[model samples]
Target: MAAATVLEVPGGPDGVREVRVSSPERLMWPADGITKLDLAEYFIAVADPFLRAVGGRPVTLQRFPEGIEGEEFYNKNPPKGLPEWARTVMCTYPSGRRHHQLVIDEVATAIWAAQMNTVTFHPWPVRAEQPDNPDELRIDLDPQPGRTFTDAVEAAYALREVLGELGLTAWPKTSGNRGVHVYARVSPTHEFLDVRHGVIGVARELERRLPDLVTTAWWKEERGERVFVDFNQACRDRTIASAYSPRPLAGAPVSTPVTWDELRDVDPRELTIRTVADLVRQRGDAWEGIDDPAHVGDVANAIALWDKDVHERGLGELNFPPDYPKMPGEPPRVQPSKRRKDREDGDYLAPKAERDAAWGLPVIPPVSPMLAKPVKAIPEGDYLYEPKWDGFRSIVFRSGDTVEIGSRNEKPMTRYFPEVVEAVRASLPEKCVVDGEIVVIGPTGDRLDFELLQQRIHPAASRVRKLSVETPAHFVAFDLLALGDDDLTERPFGERRALLEEALEGVEAPIHLTRATDDPAVAKEWFHQFEGAGLDGIIAKPRDLTYQPDRRVMLKVKHERTADCVVAGYRTHKSGDDAIGSVLLGLYTADGTLMSVGVIGAFPMARRRELFEELQPLVTTFDDHPWAWAEQEAGTRTPRSSEQSRWAAGKDLSFTPLRPERVVEVRYDHMEGVRFRHTAQFVRWRPDRDPESCTYEQLEEPVSFDLADVLGADR
Candidate 1:
């Protein structure tokens, strides 16, 4: 093979132009042994349809100097060696910067690009003459995790149906990967934003039809096992791989255009650069009539559909790409988990320093929740009594639009419960630090479900957002730590409670001021009746005492019950010694299936060693145990390890299974769903009780009561 060669490319100014191809034998697809000269020849073979698709558009070059496996870069600026016959067009980017880009006017220009090692060509949807208005609406169907190319194909077909309803003809092509790209030629009467809205409208319609198979969620975390309709591809400066453009993959696959009839069965891997030229020759271009005047569709109908969605359905503008400037009517750019943190750092909220100074607190945030000591009965004194909320202890700080939920250990939890933040912003004072409990109502809408509440504190922003809507949290404000510049921490409990009640007056559900009374008889009655509503117990606070952090200035009275559970397993102590740390307990359901209830682990060091020795004979393999499913489905969901503690990251959670023969009585406060809310204390060995008889029927069920009643009316 020669080092260089000259090829005569047709459709130039003078009918034909000679373009020099350098390194003729240099491999472009090394695996296939296809050379650079082969690429130039391939362009010549598919020149007519290729020119019709990208000739008058500003094209971006994806080049690899070596081969497909080597380092690659995107080329927007025209390369150094410019032929006089070729031309450049000035285009504006999303950043509002104008620059000249290469325009493929002839087959010689494509051949020259091949000589410069261009493998893929990304063409703008607009013509070079009209850069602001788009002539095509492009949508990229991307299959997220747990989805496949078939899902994208199904979404594309539905998208075609949607476009057809809008009087537009749809064109389908493989994305050269595990996705599909659909295009519709429209009259250049709409600007880029309007065209993007049209695409969004079509995509939303497709999603509405195939809700299970398609999604238009901009966040990847929220698009669960579905084909994501990527409407952003139609935005300004965004482009998709042109039809007949080769992708830099192992097999050198091309983004080949295909008819809707063949798209369902076509294999993208088979449409490689080495075979695409012949395929184009045999079937011709599937989009040959794409540029015909009769084929051009009006975007007015699609834009009207979008307007209907905005006006009637409230389905407004979706999220834009991060690189673009903040768009009007666009949602917040931050993901769900970081939304509150971003607000704290952004100028949208009042500065923390300003809020602190205005609140007159030495430390505005991380106000330690006042501790409580266990009491046997309602204390007789000048005290205020309220039902104890069984949820996460949090101190909420809000100023303007910013709301920060601080955990018991002083960690920022603002990202986890977005609903509570929004509720606080709507109902609470403009600036205050309120002490409250973040709780979630159970599926029955009756009691507080601590398990569901725990599910809201997830790391993935997408999961947090989904759970926020599905299982929204509520804020039960108990005390006011700070009100405006008046630091209420030094104020007596009576004054602070009165101020908190006044501040939270007229608040609504999901944000309420806890009910309190000065009557001891009412407090005693509430302590007995409120447990049915999933409240932990009654908290009696001394009216004369000031706010004290980590001090037991208040008294808590909770109900304690005993349950006989099956001794199922045991985990070793963290000290790496031969001692048992926790004893896993289980109870039989009505269907005779053993379920893990909780663990008991408050034994002394000597007793731990003794228990380890006593339980060694009962040890059994997981294969022979009822909780073996925990090992089989480790990450998805395991009963034993479902709730992970942040402080115990990387801690060994595995335990030795035991024979379900031994029964032990343990003391617990209450139930959180089916499991115990906290660690149970060992009462005694129930040698007289049968493990099979120890079922959920033996447990007491609380009477149903609405959570809204517990939160009381608006006042």
Candidate 2:
């Protein structure tokens, strides 16, 4: 091959132009042995359809100087050595910057791009002339964790139906990755934000129709195993890979457009730079009439759906990309966990001076509630035992009318439980700090309802107020940490207990001092008896133990029972190598639904590897598994599983699906809602226990008792 060659490209001012292709023998797809000249030739072959898709649009060139394996950069600015025949369009960015970008007007322009090592073409949804108003509404169907390309295809079909209802003709194309991209031609009557809202409206409707199979969650943690309808792709400056554009991947796959009927059977891998040109020649462009005036959709119709979403459904704007400026009506830019943390920290709720002033006492906010360590039995000798409250650990700070509830993590719980704050102001000492648990009673008022208590932690002040009245939380003060200006943290437990009881004597219904017993026999009796009232366990504090923040100075004893559970899946250890990190356990509900009970972790490295090998034969796909909703990769973590907690947010949640034929016995403390209160301890494999027999019925249920009795309501 020659070092360079000149080819006559059609569609020039003079009918044809000679474009010099330097390094024609240099490989563009090294693995596939495709040379730069081959790329230029491919563009020439598919020129008609390629120009229809990207012609007269501001196009970005994704270039790789070496082959696909080397470094790459996106070229928006017109590069050096620009030919006078090649045209450029001035484009405005979200950051208020403007620059002239290359426009792919003809075959010669595309050939020139190929000569510059351009592997992919990303074109704006608008024409070069009307750069501010988009003529096409594009939706990117992305498959989230536990989902696959097939899921995105399903979502795309559903989306097509949604667009059809709005009188828009939809076109489908492979993303050249593991997703799909759908587009609809619309009248350029609306600006970028309006078009973005239209896309959001359509996506939200698609999610509503196929709630199980699709999602519109902006955050990855909340998406689960569904195809995510990416509404933000229609925003200003965002673009998708133009049809017939080659992707910078192994084998040089192309983002090829396909007819609705052909989509189901089309194999994206088969449509590549080496083959797409011929495929386009054989069948013609699926979007042949996309730009026809008769086929153009009314932008007003799609915007109408957006109006309905806002006015009738109360659905509002979604989060924009992080790089964009904060948009109105959009939710907090941070992830849910971080947003909750910010709310808990009072960072979002109030100014620092205001929050500081709200804590009217000497003990400021963020007083870490003393923690407890678990013990097998209630310890003897100089110990005071109290019923362990199954609620949020909180520190109540009150100077007078103002009160602030501090969480164990030193965040504000004051806003979440407004009822508790009012109660503390009304009943507790004028200036005092008390460590307690914020709990909500069940409907029957017999047991504590942790679920309802969790519902109190809402970001919306209106919702919080509504829930506070509907599901009022009570503060059960257990220890006195301050009185007036006195800091009682250094005071002994015995002294604190006396002071706490004295301080809360004759307090109102919502506020009460925790009952304590010095006798071990009574403490043991209360441990089993209080479990029925949804009390967590028993906490025993030494008489001389001072109030130590975040320290496990107290001992706790809780009920523990073993049950055979189905081992549905296993997450790989963070260290990788397919080592078993934890096994997800499930139990059959009364309705035959397999409920995720919890997980069993904390295995030795040797046992982890051994279990990985042991479970290999039983590994299965999500297709037929009962927990098919949980799609996961073997030995890898996923966002679906990482949503469990803030600490576990970075941990791998993806697990290899098991056949649910194996049953293992696990020792659990108790149930919190449907799952275990803490990580269950592995007992032994129950080969004799049938997986179908592993139902919630087998677990021990404590007798119901009035929580008021535990709090000495009658006294």
Candidate 2 per-residue lDDT, tens place, 1-715, comes to: 3557999989776899899998888788988999999999999999999999999999888999876788899987666566778888867666543456889888898999899999899999999999999999889999987888888888888898888999999999998988999989998898999998888888888989999999999999998999988888998888888998999888789998999999988888888987898887888898898899877998778788889999998888898887675556667766887676435332444333344545555556655677787889899999998899999998888887877888877888788887888888789989998899888998888899887887787778999989988999888888998898777777798999988888887887788778888999999888888899999889999999877565566899988999999998888886676799899999998888777888999886668989999999999987877765444444222234444554345544566778989999999988977888789999999999889999999999988777879876532
Best by TM-score: 1
TM-scores vs. true structure, each candidate = 0.49, 0.49
Clash counts for the predictions, in order: 0, 1
lDDT of 1 by residue, 1-715 (tens): 3557989888665888888997888788998898898888988998888898898899999998877777899987676566777787767666543456789988889999999999989999988899889998889999998998898998888888888889899999999999999888999998999998988888888888999999999987788899998999998878889988988887888898999999999999999877888988898999999988887899988898899999999877898877676666777777665677534434444333333444343335655577788888888789999889999999998877867898887788899998888898999888788988999888888788888887787789999999999999999999997777666777799999989988987888788788889999989888877888899999999998777654555899888889999999888886555999899999888888788888999986668989999998998887888878664465423344543455467666778889999999999988886788889999999899999999988787766666677787444
Pairs with backbone N, CA or C atoms under 3 Å apart (clashes), candidate 1:
none
Tell me how far candidate 1 lies from the true structure as C-alpha RMSD in angstroms: 23.8
Report the lDDT of model 1 for residue 457. Answer: 75
